[model samples]
Target: MLLSRKAWEIDLREARKMRHSEVLGCCPHDCQDGCSWVAHVEDGKVTKVVGSKEHPFTRGVLCAKVNDYQTRTYAPDRLLHPLRRTGAKGSGEFERISWDKAIREIAFEFGNIINDWGSEALMPLHDMGSAGALQRRALMRLFHHIGASRLHGSLCGQSGNAVAAEGHPISFDPETLAESECILLWGANLLSTAHHHWHFCLEARKMRGAKIISIDPRRTRTAAKCDEHISIRPGTDAVLAAGMANVLVEEGLADFEYARSAADDLDACLEEIKAWTPDHVCEVTGVAPDDVVRIARIYGAARPGTLRVGIGPQQSRFGDVFVKSLSALAILSGHWRLPGGGLSIEGYPTFDNAAPECPELSPEGTRSLHRGQLGRILTSSDLDPPIKGLMIWGHNPLVNQIDAETVRQGLCRDDLFTVVIEQFMTDTARHADIVLPSTTQLEHFDVQGSWGHCYVGLNHPAIPPLGESKPHTEILRFLAKEMGLDEPALFADDETIARSCLPDGFDWATLNQQGWLFAPQPRRDPASMGGSLKMSMGLDGPEDLNVRDPIAIGKLRLLTVKPHYLLNSTFANMPRQAGQQGNPTLEMHPADAKSLGLQDGDRVLAQNGKGTLAAMLRVTDAVLTGTTVLEGKFWWTANEDGSPVSNRLANSNWTEGGQPTFNDIFVEVTATSGFADI
Candidate 1:
């Protein structure tokens, strides 16, 4: 195979004697902060990686996970060549094969599946594994041209983005948080998930003496450092927002003039929330009445404040309502009038409409499949033509998705043809009939947009494809030729795709030198945001509130939270990351632990109708009374002792939009010495 001309081909011994040179790049993982990084290469070897100091958002700082990216790129276990399965599925046995043979077999098998079971029988499962527009979208062109079933909606943030979009909420630059007088972090755990965004919040506290408040079910690392933390029940965020609005208006603290001018449905919203008294809200949300009143007063008195809403709370059954209600609270408070005041929800700018999904290229009227229901799609009996072929790239559904066991069972089918493209053998990859080695961020060329901030940065190839590994685009190009597909979108060169996706006026040369550029902001007039308030006013109390709270009076709501050591399941296999993350533990309140006769560090099994998981107990007051926390992603199903996977207890339920309801699960805890019966 002919590689890129810019590829590095020097040996390590020769690299050691050469001077160091810096190349600008962007982090191509599934992160809100698409951090700008500088790779310091000595001849051909990357000695170290650091955050780009010139970038406005990154500001010379990177998260702990990306700080040691070189270790992951050069890990000993990375896949370097294509392999074909030679043993039973999930046996992790494979024999090396030439690239030409691998592509030919995949094309041939895909053609057979299409001819036998119809085009819809072929489906592709993917996500933000590679956030680069070129890399993430390149594979879709081939699938679209072939009329394969499409993966619809995101595994995360679909509901929130949909709800936020309907209201046309004004979004201010995140860097302006330092100018605010008050900041409310609603469901956002910045210290753990978004360190760079947290840095700006810290600047508000240090430079402007801004009062910061946290509202969540647990006292997270970010909440512990805030001025005050308010613990509340799960799935009741919308009601809490309504209560705050009631206090603001009823107590005569609301700015009537500003609210009237900003939103046309001010009176309608006021009447709708009149019955949501502080006491009634406290009963539903498990928050103190006085605490709600205090937060309302603080929010009302500030001239300019920011409401940073995280996507966690939006993964519930009524997630869209939660987002709409919070957005309404910002409207009633009249925060959009000031420069630093507005909502900070995700709105990633589309650089090029042509590169990403190429939704237009798909054969007209093809069936769309929801990603949250992967298990059902693979095992369902109602479909006219069942899925016979699955192409997975940049995503590990077996560990990341709910109902993982069902997905594993589907993959074990002898008739199903599975293909996986990855750098390492993940749990999902182990079940594949064909495994293709893919290049890392250091050996790829692409461009990416940020969710935490507005910058869109360029990614330069820092080194050559490690061994026989190839970029995702090149792999698809080879397959397209083997299949005799000649669509223009399928054959677009990597450089052409990358250049086309740059922000409106920016060129490749200037962006490469500057490292990053801020995205163009859209102008939104607050007076025209009346439709948002109208939607919020119709949000009556959820009917299922009472039934949703107590699963069985003794069961606890399971919260599988994100971990600081890994991004989804990306770096979980690295030795350094594995040590930092340690063993997964079940965090429960002391009262809850005592009721189950469980002690700290004791082995316990959390069981529900869906599945069961074994983890060490951690009794702490940080979590709420009827809630338990289990953090981090999974690399495999069980340990040598037969414990179940972390997502075993999670169901494949979805929110009102198509987002997964990962946190809307309940389980009962029991003491166990070992998982021998698992």
Candidate 2:
């Protein structure tokens, strides 16, 4: 009675065939890469994930992270149902609950908190996790409608962006880099950190004959491939850059006429940088004085040299100062306006895309909360009130932020009610009183724009959301409705949201059909500057300026560093990536390691006045002898036995950008009694 094998297979396929349809979609993942992908659907299920050859940004290729779309969508660890904590907080105990009940409970508690402590008590900590335009806007709108406490200040790129805004705000198109003769890659390890850009850089080096100069504290993959690698002392990037400028001026390489024409106060800037001579810079940066001269001559003399400044440069105490100095260099060399020239603070083109006016969410008139003050907020000192309720989505601050112990204590507060929306049970999720399951990129429809490239991409739903999982926008809508608020204004469908957010004169339907969009060419010269120094600086030029005193003498700042790959802790749960480097470690020079009576792989305790974390020593000449490098991606949670590591030691000191100089806080390291298992 058994059917033939071929017959059985054919019959099974026929039985499963419910319908076939083509949909226009884009991958709405948190990555800056923003890949455009196609979904093959049969019987309401995604059968294949393919790159859209037509996508200008993706260019018919996908990364290893996105290639496993099926696995990530169907991962066993994904939250399939809403749950409420049934045990003590941080106990990781929960009970399954329906979505309706979960929404009602969340709304009630959130409303109560707002009534008692004002909207600022309920902080919604969000990041790139749910980057869809609708999802992001909906959350902000809901918070505004509910009068809930809001989170402000981006942990990423705010300093760099501010500096860029102050100068020539526009970004250079990525395609333009291919035409450059020389590229100065500073602090960024594009090869391992940004894979797609790494490919372009490699191509530019080998095929286009572009000379690449890498400047970083580490001998990264990007540095390895460069024509020359300049390893400077960490946190002293500004000093080195200033020295390079000094060399340019001294060697008669400065484009003084260009600076006078392009800058606001060329004489003041020149005077400020004059004291930063190569000899003085050599003493501070530890780079050879002659190397400074060589780099300045080459970078200044090269006809279309481009400077690509990495996010790492802005993660320290004087991050903003460093960015400003770098911008000043570009201005002095007349590299700010030319094609194949200028500096790139970040490769992402999303900044160039016009955003709707969101004045309510703006930081104006709001009491600022610096990211480094997590401990104080949790502890509820006399100066700061306790965070009564917390709503976290798309970001994992407990795992990523410095001073894990303080954050853990803050989350452990009995008075605090925490809600977490996530795809999986992340370290941050473990502390939540309520957990809402969220949909992945494969289960949603959205448009994506890259910070790295100019092209915008559209995402189509590749599969039905797994189990009861819902998109963040849906969750926001439900919460808004439950709170007795008008939900339409807060939540619009994906297509409508995308259309509204797109630049003027662009239609959503047209974008969907084409699967991408591009902005019009930028005007080369605005005619505002009349090619004269007097016109550029306006009347009363150099005498109208007031300069500040120089930085005081002190120990060089040593801040914890994180690359774009592990920006915060969102990606830590991805086994293939995070498991390879389980916890944060101390990166030190061999001489420094010896000075501290430590060796490679030895366990050491890195501590400041606020906290401490156990770290394994990794000795290399890449790090400056006086400084220590700690990758900032460790869960603040206690181990299986309830012991904390690196998060315990993060400094809570503040910096100008509302972020702590976590890296700049000097620490004393001592060899542990026992070495780490690694």
Model number with the top lDDT: 1
State TM-scores per candidate: 0.93, 0.86
Model 1 clashes, total count: 0
Query: What are the per-residue Cα lDDT tens digits for candidate 2 across 257-345?
Result: 77766655677777777777888777666688898988888888877677887776676666777777776677677665567677765
Q: Which ten contiguous residues of candidate 2 have the minimum total lDDT?
A: 541-550
Cα lDDT listed for each candidate: 0.81, 0.66
lDDT of 2: 0.66
Candidate 2 regions exceeding 4 Å error are 1-30, 39-53, 206-208, 347-386, 520-567, 582-585, 637-647, 673-678
Q: List the RMSD of every prediction in angstroms.
A: 4.9, 5.5
lDDT of 1 by residue, 476-526 (tens): 789999999888777788877777666556765677778787775663535
| Model 1 quality (TM-score) | 0.93
